[model samples]
Structure formats: C-alpha cells, structure tokens
Target chain A: MSATIHFTIDGVEVTGKAGQTILQAASEAGIYIPRLCAHKDLTPHGSCRVCTVMVNGRPQAACTQPVSDGAIVENETAEIKELRRNLVEMLFVEGNHYCMFCEKSGNCELQALAYRLGIQAPRYPYFFPQRALDATHPDIFIDHNRCILCGRCVRASKELDGKNVFQFIGRGAHKRVGFNAPDGLGHTDAAVSDRFVSICPVGAILKKRVGYAIPVGQRLFDKRPIGSEIEARRAKGK
Target chain B: MSTKPKVATTSLAGCFGCHMSLLDIDDRILKLIELVDFNKSPINDIKKFTDRCLVGIIEGGCSNEENVHVLQDFRKHCDVIIALGDCATMGGLPAMRNHVPLKECLEEAYLKGPTVYNPGGKVPGDAELPLILDKVYPCQEVVKVDLFLPGCPPPADTIWQALVALLNNKPLELPYELIKYD
Candidate 1:
C-alpha cells in the first residue's frame, strides 16, 4: 500500500490504497457495486460491463479502472442502473439460459443479478441462439448455451491456476471458449481442482454429478439478494 | 350482472402450473372472485367471452396457430393483458426445442422417440389439430402484453399482490421477495 487514496462513490466518501481498482476499493468500503467477470482472484478482464461506473462523468469498467485520489465515482444512478439492466438482458437473450431446469438456478450470479435488478422479463426478444454442450471432460463440462463470455474462467486458468487450458476462438457472435489441447477438455491440463473450475459466475462450466447438492432454499442468493454480505459490512459500521 | 371488473384467463402452450399457482392463493380465491367476474376463464367453465374483460391473464406462449389466435382474441377483448409465468413471458421449457428443426422435433416426438408407439408411423396431421409453429414464441412477440409476472409459476403471494394491485388500478411495483424465476 503506497498511500490512502480517498474517493467518493455515489457521494459517500470511501478510501483505498494505491493500485486498488474502484471495485476492490468499493468492496472494502462495503459499497456494493454490481459486477460480473471481475472476480477477486482473477485479473480484471472487464468483458462483462455489469460493473461499469461513471468515473468523473466518464463511463469506465470499475474492475479495470484503478482508484485515484479524490476521484468522483458514480456507482448507482438511474441511468447507470438502466444501462446495467440492459447489459444483463443482452447477456440473457444472447444465450440459451433455461434457468427453470438449470442446476445453477439459485446460485447463478447471472440469475441473481437479474433478480437484484428487478428484471421480470427482458424488453428485448429472445434470440434463442443455437449452442452446444461439451461434456467430454469426465470431471467438468462446458455448456456454451449459458456462457456470458465474461472471461472469468480464462483469466482464472491463466493467472491463478497457471494453466493455459481455456481460450476464446472465433469472431463476434461466433466467438466461444475453446480448449488449449487439440482434443476436448479431458485432453487439456484442466482439472476439477483448478481454481477456474469454481470461478465461473454462471453455470456454463460445472463439475460433474455435484449439481443440486445445496437444495433450493439453502442455496446462495436464495435467502438474500447478491451483494447483501458486502452491504452488510457497511451496516455494521464505517 | 355484477359491477366487478371482468377477468379472463387461458393456458396456451403451458402446463397450467401458473393457473395452479393462481388457485394456490387459497382463501384469497374468494376475495379474487368477489373482486372480478370470470368472463372466459376455465375456472368458471365459461367457453366464450360474453363481455369485454378488464384483464386477460395469459398463461403461456404461442407454439401454434390456436395459441396465436387465442392471444389475439385476448388483445381484442381485454383492456389489459398480463403475461403470467415464464412460459408466457419467455417461452419457458417448450422453447428448448427452438434450436432444433421442426421436422426433427416432429419425428422425435411422434415417431423416433423411445416411448413412441405409433404403429401407423404417422405424424398427427389431422385438419382439426392446430398446426405447430416452427418454434415457440413468447406472448409479447405476437401481442402487446401490458404486464409480465415471471416465474416457473409466480408464487401464490406474488399472484395475490400483483392481482390486487392490477385490480385496484395501482402502479404495479412488486417487492423483491415476491419476484423469482424458478
């Protein structure tokens, strides 16, 4: 920590150390800034714009944008909330998210975020795009239908797990997660024990045969909305 | 002739789970009946709409010609159309077949499926049967839905809150606890 960098998130004064991103700073300050793709253990890829914040009137991804001294950050505004909701909806329509039958139903970050945003139904039409499921890996599987292209798994694998197991291939709408090995995930160095295996915010990547273990009401985000724990920190004190 | 606002409901390409959830309101059913008259709802076994309805609660999506026609009729006769449940709002489970071709789906369902016992090896192509669309579509794609109450089947409490608000002509703002997808 170089020095204490103080900032205002939504007009509430918060402080952080040097080199800390707005998200990390806000998380410490107990101000819940909604995000996906930017995990604590992973490098901030900023692919999912769910955590976009206004830094002195400029829209920036909070995860990637480092905190500066006396910076004016707007986390929750009517306009920002609307943009986040729309971005989340795009992620919904862009994939084949059959949440009713999905194993990640309650624990899924995507679903929890949608609920937190009060999005009963997305305004846009469902694309219902064609996607595939890769179950070649005996321990873990990838369902492209639920992938938000957030790059969390990619970052986690390379930066944390130290294995170049996952990578994105193709262009634009055709872009999807591909493996390092010529063969399927089973052929790759990816393992069930990899940190990337547990880093997926959505159910796109899941471990084999362990789904629905937590039960319905006991799952995360079931009792309370996402970010409650972070906000609870603020309620406790400064 | 009751002065109460009339409400009509129908299940299209749905499993009637939403309707079941509506009934799951339990004792509130009496309150709901007191508040609104059943115009064309199956609950009252009324086949035809004898009068214009205040609210038309749609239970599912349009997977066929009949569903489309029924939704169109709702739009015509009802002042407000509420798309109730995931099926009506997002095409729900039936939409899983959207990625596959219609021919393949038909063959899988009517002929090639493991449980199929079609000795005639014939797809049901009767003139009376409604023709299935290429893919299931949400209600909003076909008609203007005034509101959407999403869930597999929105909880009974959720239904009660929404219906009460809608009936009272109040701005619908559901508490976070009442809203859920599954």
Candidate 2:
C-alpha cells in the first residue's frame, strides 16, 4: 500500500510519497522553500509566487507542482532566487505596507521571506490600491490595503465559520474582498468567536483591540525568521 | 443656510462605529461642519424635510424591513448615498449567517429546546419582519451608491481627506498605508 516517487532536489536524490508536492517533500526532507500564502491547515493559494522552483529547467510554483519519478528539481538556483526577489517586490508595490507601523512586524511571513531573499528595496512603483477598512465589528478589522489577495481570510470565513462572508470582487488590480451581504457587521449574523482573524498570515485581517499589547520584545516569532521558526516549532512537535 | 451641499448620516443595522469614526475626527468635525450643512445625524436633531440634500451617508447593512425602507428613502431624497462601513460595503460580519438556511438560523436562535413563551407557538408568518435576502448584498445591490468608503469605518485622517476631495471636486486617492489590511 506504499507508493514512492524519487526526484532530485538541489542535485540531491530524494524520495517522497507519490502524491506529495515538491514543496511538501522538500519541507519533509529539511529543504527550505520560501512561501507566504501556503499554510498547514488551508489549501494552497499560489498568489505570492515566492515558492517557485526550477523543474526540469523551467520555473514553477513548488507548492502546486507534484513530485515525479526521476524529475530534476533545483531549489537553490540564482535564477529562482532572483524570481523570488522579483515576486516579493511586486507584492510590496501592489499594496501599502509600512513595516514599522505594522503590528505583525517581527512575526510577519512576508517580511521574513523578504529578509531571507535579501530584498533591499522594491524596484516597482507602488500601486497604492484603494482599500476600505471594516472596523464595524468590535473585535477584528479588515484592511484591504495590507491584503495580498491570498484568499486566506476568505477561506477562513468559509471553512471555519461555515459562512462565505468574504469573497473577491472584480478582476486584476481592482480585485478586493466583499461581503456576502451589504449589511454592516452589526446587522449580519457573523459570529465574533470565529478564529479567522488569528489564521490570517498577513496583516489584511487583524485583531482590532489586541495590537501593541504584547510590546516589541515578547511577541511570538519575533526573534527569528519564519523558516527557522517553522523548524523550531517542528522540533517541538507543535 | 449656506449654498454648500447638505449632508445627512444615519445607521440602520450596524454598530454605530462608522458614525463614531466620523466623529472621531476629533476637532476636525468642526471643520467638516463648517464646510457642509449638517441636516440630520445621530448627534444632531432628527428632522424630516422636503429639501434636496447633496449627500447622504448610511453606515450599516439592510437586515430588516425598516432598514430597506430607510435605504430607499435615502435614495429618494439624496443626490448621492455612500455606504461607509464593511457591512455597508460587503456585509462585514453579519452576513456570515448567509451560509445557514434561514429556517435553521431561526431554530438555533429561537426554537431549539428552549422553554421560551413561543416554544409551542408557530414561527410568525407576519409581513412586518423584513424578508431576509437569500444572500447578503452590498449597498450597490439594493440601490445606486455614488461612492464607497470601505474600512472597518476607515481611519479619521482618511475620512477627512475624502471629504476634502469631495468638496474640491478632486479624485479621492487613498495612500498605500491607509488601504493596507493590517
């Protein structure tokens, strides 16, 4: 009942489950792949493009690519690092992100990934997309500008709460999250107890009243990069 | 009154946070009051008049019959209507119940096994309770909205800048920091 697939990653031969993705296999084998939108509980949304790896001489998102027998995978190529850097730069310009003021500063996955890739400054012109704030609920907030369109909040709303409250509207740069109804937070029946706010990997959706309460030194994942943090958590069996 | 456009604000089904955000402008509300004629608001006297108003701001979603009627009335009276909160823009939090069937929601909230006075009584079929829309809709679905100022209620500075843009007839632009989700 066991099926295995062999592939070469960074010139090293590795074996994984037949249905495993390259990223999944790489992670199990202690290979670091930079990603923002990929989470353990949620489905993969390849919006960030930071996990792209060269497969048989072509670059593709490692999170979506399945590991095949005898396939050649390169995770540490200069071209891939450059591509990841460019992807991170695009993400920075597509939204408004002031890391100094952000509550997620030290613990942010995007910020950690950027530091890992050594992005000094974004080359693209900032789009400064017009986004709305939804502080209607007393506990949480939805800031459209910090959103990278990763659909984590949307998925959280649907999967955890059983409510498809948030959805993407429009196309391209005009794309933004919308409610299932026009009613404000007080009027709609959304429960305040849902964990969607905590699950959001980025600052797009946030806990309203809890910001700055933990101070700078004590926040979780504050002292290390996300990759290392993941490694640490794994070591602890978390 | 001055020749400037008269603006009215009201809340329907939402928490009054959006209105609070408008007032949170600190002393800036004084400046805004000087620019536009404040006709009706939660902080001011509630009066009904036939005078044509230039802008009407409604914060909240239409969850019941009265909420719908109020939105329609605002549409009839004002030249522009702005949905100012997440509930107004995209059913913010309340629309989360759209996933459940209306009957199931009623059972969970009222009926179930609870021994309330109406435990044995049939659910009221009266027309007074507003018919719940099958799906939560943004303000644009119920009526034409001139502009959308999305945010939990948006920051006070963003609101001030938007008002200034409206007064000067300039395109409203939000800074990247202001629009970000965090």
Candidate 3:
C-alpha cells in the first residue's frame, strides 16, 4: 500500500501519493502553478523561478520541493504575483523579444504567461542585444534573440532524446545555448524528430517551413487563456 | 466650432496596416465619427494639426529625424498620446535593422546589391531628405506614451473598444480576444 500526502494550497485541501512534489500534486489536484522549465516528460528543473511558492512560510520552488503532510502552500498571493510579474518583465527586456513578428507569438508559453500576468509593457529598459540566428540546419533553426535560457532544450535533448546536443555556454548575460558541434547546428547530430524540437517554450527554437502555418487568432493560447484548462478541470472536479 | 473630441493619428516607420485595421472596423467607423472628430489624420488627409487634439494615436516606431519631429509635434498639440501598434510599442519589424550597422544598410540599399540599376548609384544625400536615426526606437522610448495598444496591428474591434472607452472617459476594458501581441 502507498502512503498518501495531504497539503493545503491557498487554503484548499489537496491530496497526493507519497514522493510527489508540490507542483506535481497540485497539478494532479487541478491547481495551476505558472512554470517554464518543468515539463511532464522531463525531470523537474527549478531554474526559471516562475513557480516559486511559499512552503510553510519559506520560499521554495514548487517543482523541486516535495510535498509533506500538513504543508501550507501559497501559490497565488499578491507578493508572489508581483514577483512573477517582475520576473516576467525582466525576461522580456533581457531578450530581443519582438513578439509582433515572432512565429511563436500566440502559441508561445512566455507570451501567454505575460497575458496571464497582465504585463502590458515591460517596466525595465530593453537591452536590444545583438544575437545571431543559426539557419545552418536545413530542418531547424535557432534564434538566440528570443531565448530565455530556461534549459528545456538542453534537458530534453540529453534526458529524453539521449542526443546530448544542447548545452549552456558562458555565464550570466553572456550565457547562451550552444550546440555540441563547433560549426553550429548543421554539424550537430540533432534531428527534426528529436523531443527537443517541440519542447521549446518560446520562439527561440523553431522548425523550418512551418512559420505562420496556423495563422493568427487561432493558436493554442488564442482559443483560451493560459491555465484555463486546468482551472476548467478544477471546476469539473467539484 | 463643433464640440466633439478631436483625435489625430500618424504612421512613422511602419506599414500602414494598423490604419488599414482601423478601417477594418467596418461600419463602426460611423459610430466613431459620431463620437469623435478626426483632426490631423491620413483618413481625413489633413496635412498638419490646426488645433489642439484631445487624443493622438501613433502607429509605428521612430526611425528618422522626421518621425521624431512629427511625434514631438503631436505631443505638443495633443492631451493624450496612445502608441497604437506593436511597432509603436516595441519597434516591431523595423527593429530588425537594429542588428546591422546603419551605414551597411544604407550602402546595401543604394550603392551595392542586385537591385540598383545605376552602376554608380550614390547614397541619397539630398538636403531635403529627413536624416535617419542610427536605430529605430519605440514610441515610449522617444515620448511619454499615455497608453499602448499592442499587436502587429491590434484587431479593429480592439481599436473600436479602446476608442469608445477613451471617448467616454472610462477605463479601457480589454477582453482576452482583443488583447493579442501579434
């Protein structure tokens, strides 16, 4: 017999099996925590900090922090919302995110989260850093301008596909995603069918010849706001 | 003089797609006419502002001295300035040029490449031409934008709703469908 863990998120009692993280349990319980780096198929990485929740009055990443009996989790409070907004805004200004022309505009998780957080415009000054595009690969391309360095592609490439093609280079502002080969993506053994291809949360990693295929006003986030599906599932659970 | 609220609009270093989208409001423009008066706008073909405007709607980013001058003029003569498209909000497509040096861009366009018919074509240095800025800048970076309506071109219904709300002195109510970044 498996042990069960009980927790309260925003005062709502939720239950989960033992050895589940707060994010996993909350998600199965129909609660939504905004996240960027954590995906269902891959192991949890608490790099983005967008899913930081108060666990027993201390801040911890919900994705990495394991749930325990009688733990009080605060996911949606004013302080957390404002912190998330600032983090989101910083991500915007840090990248050359020209969302208007991006192929991932409506479908991008970052843009959807910005809308979900009510970010009309970034409060910080735009860096407008000069970044390069890698069109060397025939099937796929990488635009460094839009990358947030959440390490999704690196993790997916290494763990899921077992290709180990993507890795992080440098540190801080100079840090960026790099391919295994020195000549760029063309020389790398990455395939279009790799799991990393679809795991990107933004327009940084894109497949060729599919730009604007779905058309505007009809993408995933266009039909419904982010977290609405989970919230809908929560409503249905009652 | 008519007591209707006066509004003006302009497009800087942008495609006039936003203005076209404004026309996309269909017959709702008639309701807009009843609500506000067009002052200096391409719709009215008014060359310049002759009177103070209650609202100034600007589309596109500033890429040259003339765009800056026009934006400043609007700021001088208008009470509220609205950055009315993605270009005006974040430099948009025109900002793609920010990666390359302006001199290289000008040389490629005028002196080199396949498009130039004249072999000795010189860069246009006419005294009458507006001097280009080193890089394109969003409207907010250049001026104090009172409001921003972001999209490649914000949908016409979104424009209509914002216009109506501004004219009625109410907070603009943006529904999910109307608030798209692209």
Which lDDT values do the candidates have, in the order given? 0.92, 0.72, 0.90
DockQ of each: 0.81, 0.01, 0.60
lDDT of 2 by residue, A123-193 (tens): 56445444577778676777776788778777877877787777888998688877776854544556667
Q: Which model is ahead, 1 or 2, in terms of TM-score?
A: 1
> Model 2 chain B — which ten-residue stretch has the worst lDDT?
B173-182
The TM-scores of all predictions, comma-separated, are: 0.97, 0.54, 0.95
Candidate 3 per-residue lDDT, tens place, A1-238, comes to 6699888999999998888889999888889999988888889989999999999999999999999999999999999999899999899988899887789988999999998887777767677889999999999999999999999999999999988898899998899999999999999999999989899999999999999999776799996888888788789899
Give Cα distance to truth, residue A14, candidate 2, Å.
2.4
Q: List chain A TM-scores, every candidate, in order.
A: 0.97, 0.89, 0.98
Cα lDDT, model 1, residue A72 = 98
Q: List the residue pairs that clash in candidate 3.
A: none
Question: CA lDDT of A44 in candidate 2?
Answer: 74
- For candidate 3, lDDT tens digit of each residue in B1-182? 88999999999998999999999999998888998889999999998998899999999999999999999999999999989888898888998888889999898888786777756578888989999999999888888989888887889998888888888899987988777888
lDDT tens readout by residue for model 1, A1-238: 3899998999999999999999999998899999998898877888888999999999999999999998999988999999999999999888988888888889999999999999989999999999988888999999999999999888888899888999999989899999998778989988899999888989999999998898777888877999999999999885
User: Sort by TM-score, best first: what order?
Assistant: 1, 3, 2
Chain A TM-score, prediction 1: 0.97
Question: How many backbone clashes are present in model 2?
Answer: 25
